[model samples]
Target: KMHRTVLALVNIFICGCFASPPNFILLFADDLGFGDLGCYGHPTSLTPNLNRLASGGLRFTDFYCTSPVCSPSRASLLTGRYQTRSGIYPGVLYPGSIGGLPLNETTIAEVLKPMGYATAAVGKWHLGVGPKGMYLPTNQGFDQYLGIPYSHDMGPCRNLTCFPPDIKCFGLCDVGVVTVPLMHNDVIKQQPVNFLDLERAYSDFSTNFITTSVKKKQPFFLYYPSHHTHYPQYAGPGAAGRSLRGPFGDSLFEFDTTVGNLLATLEQTGVINNTLIFFTSDNGPELMRMSRGGNSGLLKCGKGTTYEGGMREPAIAFWPGTIKPGVTHELASTLDILPTFAKLAGATLPRVQLDGVDLTGLLVNRGKSQREEMIFYPTDPSEMYGLFALRLGKYKAHFYTRGATHSGTTPDKDCPVFAVLKAHDPPLIFDLEADPSENYPLPLVGRPDLQKLLDRIMKVKAQFEASMVFGESQINKGTSPELEPCCNPSCSPKPSCCHC
Candidate 1:
């Protein structure tokens, strides 16, 4: 009888060890502002579904994107590395845009695909497109791709004017001049459709993918990168003029509905308990001309610069019976998603260094905080926005490029009015606990210890820049035939070695 019991125990252990992993559903909203959601405190905005999600699971108060833009941020999220490391430092990638994710860099989908998870990316895929080898989603790792190659607003529109009034008509608008054709794999599947209808289509595709996976009893990873609340402000037919705020708010409400529909579908299918849903934005809202849709509240600066408004985003993870609900003020980045998902899927990644660390433990444990410090940099060159900022606890330091000036104005030109002279140059430090808004800069007087902290931040910033330069150089060497002809035998010499 004792021998029989031991055999039974061994069988149970083996069964448990070979159990299937949980499915993953990552919902990424395009250009959704931090204050757009109701749970994140939008007095006029309504995000009932997302609010419910926050109540049901975890709401991260201080979550951030790696960059304040799309492509770079998405690249970082997928690879779990800084964009600079993967040569994805920039604004949105055009069809023929040169550099994308390096071939050597592995994505979360690639890691999970081998682990038996069916991966699909539905909605916006702003990484890249066209002839570039690294541009396609299929090349990256996604098994199925159904989404726009870039932002919804990238397509030709009837009106190319500013927001609030610069509304673009769908079918009436001129196509080739303003918008690019929507792509499926490498082919142009359709001309740009109405923004509202496009979203619904995205929802339908996502729902179908999830339902099919559930029916098949196969674990799947759905990357739902949405194209809501971005621009060309037009909510669907039924949702138009629903919000009191404006078209932008109306669009946000529609986005909330999409989230609701997705969640409800999961629950209805009885897969909510076995699925992990992550929701976040590509960056902070565009606070300049597109201020109608964005709300930075008390945070300083807006999109396109390394500031609270630019990088700090609304992040939440919902996995019923798994993640606990409530606010977590831990410092987290989009880069953390790759490693976190990999861990949950029980997948192994190639031996490549990634800047982000897995925060699965912190997500599961209520009291745990993941990051001690984070570095942020912008890739835009128009503003000559060569700046790096480091956040180590409360002390934050902004290191400007040699001749670059600091300014508060959105898209400011002709030398920053707020530029401080070298004599008075000092790192702007704030006690975030007391001043989350960073309204008042800390006085540099009397605190020698604080000065030392600033110095350390600068040192770290220097190291980061050096590493980026070195990586770029290596990529150049690899792509350049003159530099090394034997290195790349089939090399046709792309714009950047990083494109490989």
Candidate 2:
């Protein structure tokens, strides 16, 4: 009955022959916090474009990423499975990491590309890039790709005075292995990419893809994962020190403008009505950068933890004619993107245990979210891919709680990084709807009324654990010199290494 109902809802939009399959543009942000945008309540980081986007589209207050860090979170977003299920566990993959997201695990691009969609990917491709660059986005079903294979800040900075002073690690300062390659279709175009010109380059890449695809009358999917609001932040041309909230705000302002430019291109090309744009972050803020990092709003902690602040993101879904504009507090995740896009393209899901519930109904008709519960995976290496927290309805139970990596010892008791490693017996539960800050814990030791809730949660957890078949450990496979994206094997490093 559920399957039949889902098919019926899908037919309501695609109707008859999947007429005019909508274009999908997933604008994924890097380390953007919930409170980073004015729409989500950034007091000073004035985000006019993003604010306008939320006003004109649907905003999700309770949206999330599957994991709190880069590679794992991206894996789940693309595959619609938990990061562990896809073997991107134990935190993010480094530049020369030998392994990547398993080739067998199907991605959103893989699902859509075969359905006659001209797929292009831009910005950061952090999932993995090694083993002869076989793990890059081009191999993962994208027809065209441009940008760095990993975080731009992974390599040592040439100069720190241009970046935020609070930035802790000046790009793997000691090792300095990641000389980020600016690649286009697996070919290196630039090394140690000039960040200053990144905004203009990205704009040209995305707009050109949109324009060319439209001219060919091909439905397109552009997954533009941006490099914004992360460490070593720099504003785009004409965007520096403009937000008045500091350099972080400056970068955010430029990101908003970049998005605005895409929207304009869609409008100019007369495809705005047929485009489905999902704007969200890969994970939460990086708290180590202090003022250079993003704000999690009322949520606890930041990147590299299971806290809401680490995983929860600001989400906006815009479709000019189809989707009704409004705010939804219903639970959603980046995991749902694959299933939802599959449903949109009339494609079948890959034969595997997918952890996402399609949000087509909620996205198109303002119906209730298909999801009721959420499982939070630990992003901190110490926790080792364990289930850190569970959210059943409004109540969230934290089986284990820890702080972000490099967060250091702090006097802030509200931060909640315990000195000792003792698992909770009863589990600290919170009514997230009421206390979004996670300051007050609902003591479960003596509350008989909460026993049933806990039981229900445990039952689900047990089921998840029982059916789990974790994929091969890709991240744990140590980095190899063979995986580095050095264009010339003979050169020393950048500045002299492959300039062309």
Candidate 3:
């Protein structure tokens, strides 16, 4: 009797130690706009699956990405720290960029690794490219990786830089001019994957990962970062010309179907109620693409600007049994994802201070948002010193003004409306609650004019300046000979690194 009791106790303890935690599927879209999804008020693009997910869970209307571009926003999403703090400050990583999310930073995957969650990173991983294994996803806590290393357009374009100055040139002259290697964990699975099949492959990888993880009885964290809707728009087979909006719309449609299938997989595994799913974008659409560029709806400018449209990404969180289905206008940023997941998984947050707060309460319908403000920075690939926008409660104050007529031409510094009366000297304030589009600006500094606002801005700026240390961006850093994949059948660089 004693032996039986001891065995029972030991079994209970072991099971308790490895009990199933909630699975997380972070479905990240590349350059998807706030107004692109049907749930977010897009008129045409078929995103039924995403809309359905939103209807089943909580949809956030005013959710923002940390930056107006990709790598910085992704870094912030993973670490719950500003890109400036995470060392990806100025720009996006390129094809063979040396620098990546610093090893010191504790990623969300790393935090959940201790809980025995099976983690996989699928699709685009613009963080870094490698001959060195350290920059790959496996080293960064992901158990498996199957995807492209950077933006798809980075491959050789037949036309000028593969941007295709004319829409007619798309898929004709310059699409997939350069070959992007298909990475499977640290090895190059395919020398150059056909762009036409990219979307379907990503979907297959994701669902397979989930299926395998479930079979192993392991809770999983699947980071599916789609590589569509950026530029050089190529539609995967069966998705071509499917949307009325052209290639961009086709990509959206494919993504929606992919989401639906993923949800279906979760349901099939009998873990739909235990899985936490998130659908959001790295940033807004690329307006430079003109007709091919996505509309930001009522929001100001598109990607690369600090306007609402640039930073405000469409976001949806779904956990069938946990989150109540409702739309939240509360201010939320991708930065909050880390701490929220930490709390959900009962994982330890890093000892260092973090920018994001725990949003588990809001997720559970327990309380209002703990976040009240957010700071907007200048566009990357430009001079750093430019206008900064501060959002305090309902009022958004811009210390400097830029003549942002459209997406790309926003000036590097504050633009002058007059010869002497500099518009930004007193700061231009807008009531975002009244004007979500940021059309009209309240008159410059008046009696008690933004004194509190100025004080708050100064305080945060001072703190940032005091502690912030800028890291060298690896953008366009020449691909080192050592970073090249070992193509020889008999030779391997390192067993842990990439082997062709």
**Which candidate should be chosen as best, given TM-score against the real structure?**
2
Q: How well is each residue in 1-500 modelled by candidate 2, as lDDT tens digits?
A: 99756665664556223357788999999999888889998789878888887998999999989888888888888899988788897878888898898888899999987778999999999988877789999999999999988887876665533333323323443244646668998998877676777777888999999999999999999999998877777764568768888888988888888888999999999988888899999888877777777888878877777778888899999887777789998999998999998887777889888999889889877889999988888764333435778898888888877775533332444344443344776788899999987888887677888988899988887787777777778888888765677878667663246444
The digit string of per-residue lDDT tens for model 1 on 1-500 reads: 99655544543342233245778888888767677778888888877888898998899888888887788888888888877667765455654444556667798889889867888888778776534335668888887787767766654465532232334543333232224445555555555444546667777878888898889888899998877766656677656778887877877777788888888889889888778889998887765434454776666655666667777889998887777777888888888888888777666765887777778777776656667778767644212343466788766665542112222344433113343322115766767778876556688689798778777777776665565531341122223212211112254442122111
Best by lDDT: 2
Candidate 2 vs candidate 3: the lDDT winner is: 2
For model 2, the run of ten residues with the poorest summed lDDT: 160-169
Candidate 3 C-alpha RMSD relative to the actual structure: 6.2
The CA-based lDDT of model 2 is what? 0.81
> Model 1 off-target regions past 4 Å?
1-19, 132-134, 159-178, 381-387, 401-425, 462-500
Q: TM-scores, in order shown?
A: 0.82, 0.92, 0.85
What pairs collide in candidate 2?
none
lDDT of 2 at 103: 88
**Candidate structures ordered by TM-score, highest first:** 2, 3, 1
Regions of candidate 2 where Cα sits further than 4 Å from its true position: 1-18, 160-174, 380-385, 406-411, 414-420, 492-500
Cα RMSD of all models vs. native, in order, equals: 7.6, 3.8, 6.2
